[model samples]
Target: MVDLMEHAGANPGRGTYGMAMAASRTVFEARRDCAALLGVKDPRDLFFVSGCTEACNLMLKGLLQPGDRVVVSSMEHNAVTRPLHVLSGRGVRVDFVTADTAGLVDAEAFERAVAEAPTRAIVCQHASNVTGTIQPIGDLADIAHAAGALMLVDGAQGAGHLDVDVAALDVDAYACSGHKALLGPQGIGVLYLRSGLDAMQLVEGGTGASGADEPGQPLDRPERYEAGTPNTPGIAGLGAAARYQSAHGAGIRATERRLTVRLREALSAMDDVVLLGPAPHDESVPVVSFTSPRAEPDRIAFELDRRFGIAVRSGLHCAPWAHRTIGTLDTGALRIGIGHGTTDADIDALLAGLDEVLA
Candidate 1:
C-alpha cells in the first residue's frame, strides 16, 4: 500500500491510459475483495465513497424522491437519522420504529410503521454502534419487501465483525465503513446496491468518457456512481485490510466476543453500574456500554484515560435516538469497543480501571 502511494506520488500523471488501466485494476480488485467479504457476487454492485456517512447519504438521497415516506429504526446512528432528517425537511415523511431496552428493534413495530403509511424504504442498522445489539435484519428485510418498500442496512458496525451475507438478508442497499470493524484506513467506505436497483446518482462529474455531449450521460454501474479521481491509496489499504480480515476473521471475532462477555459480566456485577443493551452473553458485536450512578460518563472516561492509560468513547456517540430508545438520552453512557487486536490483558486493564474510578 505504501509502495503504491509512493509510486502515485512520484508519477502524478496516473490519468494516462496505461496508468489509468493499472489504477482501474487496483480499484476493481479492491472492490472485488470487499464484495467477497460482504457475500456480494458481483464487485460492480459495490461503490466506494469517502466514508460510511457519504455512502449512507448517497443511498438515502439517491433512492428517495421528494415527499417519499421512509421507515427507520430508533437505534440508527446519526449517519442514517441525519440524512433522513434532511430529506424530511425536503418533504420526505420519516417515521421511526422504536427499539426495546435491549436495543433490539421490534419487527412488529416496523411492520406497523410500514403498514401505516405508503413507505418507500425501510432504513436500519445491522448492529447498534452504541450498544452492540445485533438487529434482526433478515426479518426486517422480509417485512420491508412484503410491504413493497426497499430495505437499506447500515453495516458500519456489523461488517468485518459479524458474518454478513447481503444475499441472505435480502437488502436492497448496504453501507459500511472501512475504518470501523474492517480495520482499514479512514476516509474509505463501501456501498452495495442490489442488482437492477436504479439509484439516482448523488454526485456527477468526469467518469472517463461516455461519448455523449450531455454531462448527465454518465457511465454505467460502478462508474456511474463513482465520480472524479478515486482514492487509490485509501482503496489499496482497505483492500489489504479486507484480505487480512478474510483470512483471520473467525479467530478475531472469537477473541472479541470473549472480551466483550468478560467486560459485560464485570460491569453488570457492579452495583452502581447500569449496563445498557442486551444481556451479558447475547448475540452482539464486541461493544459494551454502561453508566455510573455516582460518576458522569465523561468524567469516568477522562479518569480512565488519565489515570489508567485506557481510551474509551463517551456520550451519545452520534445516535441520540439510540440513547433515547435505551433511556439514556438525558445522560449518555460510557462505551468500550473491542477490536480485532484487543487482548485479554486490555480487557482486564479496563475492568480494573472501571473498579478504581467507580470506587
Candidate 2:
C-alpha cells in the first residue's frame, strides 16, 4: 500500500507539520469528494463533525424551532431518534413514521408524516443498524420537500455500503461516521448539507480560523460546525480511507453481497434459526441478523465469542423499533456485519459456529 501511494499523490515523507497541513486540506477535500460520492455538488456544503451523533444533534437543533414538529422513522438509530426524543421533552412535537415488520420505513407513511402542518423536518435513517433494512430516501425526500420540510438522513450504515446521490435524492442533510464503512479511525464523520441549509451549532468554541467575534466560532463550512481543535491525525487517515474506498469500493460492495447471500442461505437452512428483517436480504447491506428458538440473543452472542472466537454484535443495536418489528424486541437478534475486508473464511467461521450452537 505504501508503494502504491507514490502514484496516488499522498507522500508519507511530507514532514509532520506538512502532513498536518495536508490533512487539514484533505479534510476539506474529503468533505467534497464524499459529497460528490453521495451526489451532492458542492464540497463547501459538507461539514466534518465528531461523528454521526453530533451531526444529528446539529441538524435537530439548527433546524427546528420551539413549537416545530419533527418526523422520524421507528427504525432509526438512537443517534437520530434519541436527539428528537430529547427535543420532544422540550415541547417539540415528534411523530413516528412507521416501519413494516421487515424493519423498512413505509414510504407512503413517511410522506404522510411530513405532510402535516407545523412539521419542521423529517429525519430518516438510510439503513437500519440492527437489521440493515434500506429506506426509500429519494422518494421520501420528494415527499418531505413537497411538505416544505427538510430531510435529514442518518448514513452511519449506508454511506460506505450503498450508493447515495444527495442531489438526486433531494435530501437536506446526510450524516455518516468515518469508521464503519469508510474504514477510517473513530471520532471522524462527514455531514453533507444541501446548499442554503442552515443547521444551528451544537457547541461554540475555537475553529482555528476566522474568530474575530466575541462568541468565537466561524459561520462557514468546516469551521462553523467544527469547534475547538480538529482531529488532524484521524482526518488524515480518513483522507486515505476515502481514497481507498474510491478505488476499491465497487469491488467491496460486490464481495459483501456475495458473502452475505451465502451466509443468509446457510442461516435459512437451519431449522430452529429464524432470519430477521427482509427475505432474500436484497436491498440491504452485508448485515445478517437472526434469532434461535432455543436461546436468547445475549447467550448466542456470548457463545459465539467464547467458543469460536467469532465477533458479532447482539442486543437491540440502539434501534428498538427494528428489534420490535422483527419480533426480537425482548431479546434482540444476533447480528453479523460483513465489511469490505470480510472474507469467505470469515463467513464460514460464523456459519460453523452458529450450526454448532444450534446443534
Candidate 3:
C-alpha cells in the first residue's frame, strides 16, 4: 500500500503516460479487490465515491424522481433517511417500516408497505449502526422482487461483517463505507449496482474518454457514474485492505463474534447497565450498545477513554431512528465497536472501565 501510494501518484484514468497507466491499474486493482470482497461478479458493477453518504445520495437522488416511491426501514442512518427526506420534499413518496423494540424490521409489514403503492425501490440498511443487529435483507429483497421493486441496501455497518453476496440476496444496489469494516482508509467507498440497473449520474465531468463530443454524460456502464480524477492512493490502500480481509476474514469474524459475546455477557451481568438491540446470537455483527441510568453517556465515554485508553462512541451513532427503535433515542447510547484489531484484552479493558464509570 505504501509503495503504491509513493509511486502511483499520477491521476487515474486520464493520462497516456506510463505513470498514468500505473495509476489506473492501482485504481482498478482497488475496484477489483473490493468487488471480490463483496461477491460482486463484475468489477464494473461498483462505483467509487467519496463515501457511503455519496452512494446513498446517488441511489436516492439519481434514481427516484418526483412521485416515485421508496420503502425504507425506520432504523436507517441519516445517510439514507436524509436523502429520502430531501426527495420527499420534492414529491417523492418515502414509506417507512418501523422496526420492533429488538431492532428487527417485520417483513410482512414491509411487504404491506410495498403493496400499498407502486414503489420504485425498497431501501434499507443491512444492519443497525447502533445495535449491530443485522436486518433480514434477503427476506426484504424477496418482498421487493415480488412487488417488482429494486432492493437497495446501505451496507455501511454490514458490508464486510455479514453475508453480502449480491446474487444470493438479489440486492439491486448496495452502498458501504470502506473504512468502517472493510479495513480500508477513510474517504473511500463502493456502490454496488446490479448489471442492467441504472442510477442517474452523480456527477458530470471528464470520464477520461477520447472526446467530449457527446452531449450530457455518456450512458455507458461505469463511465456513466464515475467522473473526474479518483483518489488513486486511497484506492490502493483500500485494495490492500480488501485483499487482507479476503485472506483472513473467517478468523477475524470468529474473533469478533467471540469478543462480542464476551462483552454482552459481561455487560448483561451488571445491575446498572441496560443493553440495547437484539439478543446476542450467530445472526448478528459485533456492535454492542448500552446505557446506564447512573452515568451520562458522554461522561462514561470520557472516563473509559481517559482511564483505560479504550475508545468507544457515545451518542446516537448517527442513527436516531435506530436509537428510537431500541428505546435509546432520548439518552442515546454508548457503542462498543469491536473491529479487526480488537482482542479479548481490549474487551476486558472496556468492561473494566465501564464498571468503574457506572459504579
Top candidate on lDDT is 1
| Worst lDDT 10-window in candidate 2 | 4-13
Which regions in candidate 2 have their CA more than 4 angstroms from the true location? 1-20, 211-216
Error of 3 at 131 (Å): 0.5
lDDT of 1 at 227: 78
Tens-digit lDDT string for candidate 1 (1-359): 68676554322123566556666667878899999989998888999898899999999999998979999999999999999999999989998888999899989889988999899999999999999999999999999999999999999999988988899889999999999999899999999999889998888777665544674846478878887777888888898888888999888999899889888898899998999998998989998999999799999999999999999989999999999999999999999999977998998898888889989
lDDT of 2 by residue, 1-359 (tens): 23223323342223346544454565566666666666768777877778888777887877787798888888877887788888888888988877887888888887766666667778888888887788888888888888888888898898889866777778899888889987887998878877777778787876655454656566677577777666655666676787778778899988988887888888888898998877765678778899888888789899999999988888988888667766788988889989977898988888888878877
- lDDT score for candidate 1 against the true structure: 0.89
Q: By TM-score, who's the top model here?
A: 3
Full-model lDDT, candidate 3: 0.86
Poorest 10 consecutive residues by lDDT, candidate 3: 275-284
- Measured with C-alpha atoms, the lDDT of residue 78 in candidate 1 is 92
Give the Cα error of residue 44 in candidate 3, in Å: 0.7
Model 3, total clashes = 0
Q: Each candidate's TM vs. the true structure?
A: 0.96, 0.91, 0.97
Check candidate 2 and list the clashing pairs: 38-165, 38-166, 62-200
Q: In model 2, how large is the Cα lDDT of residue 16?
A: 46
Least well predicted 10-residue stretch by lDDT in candidate 1: 6-15
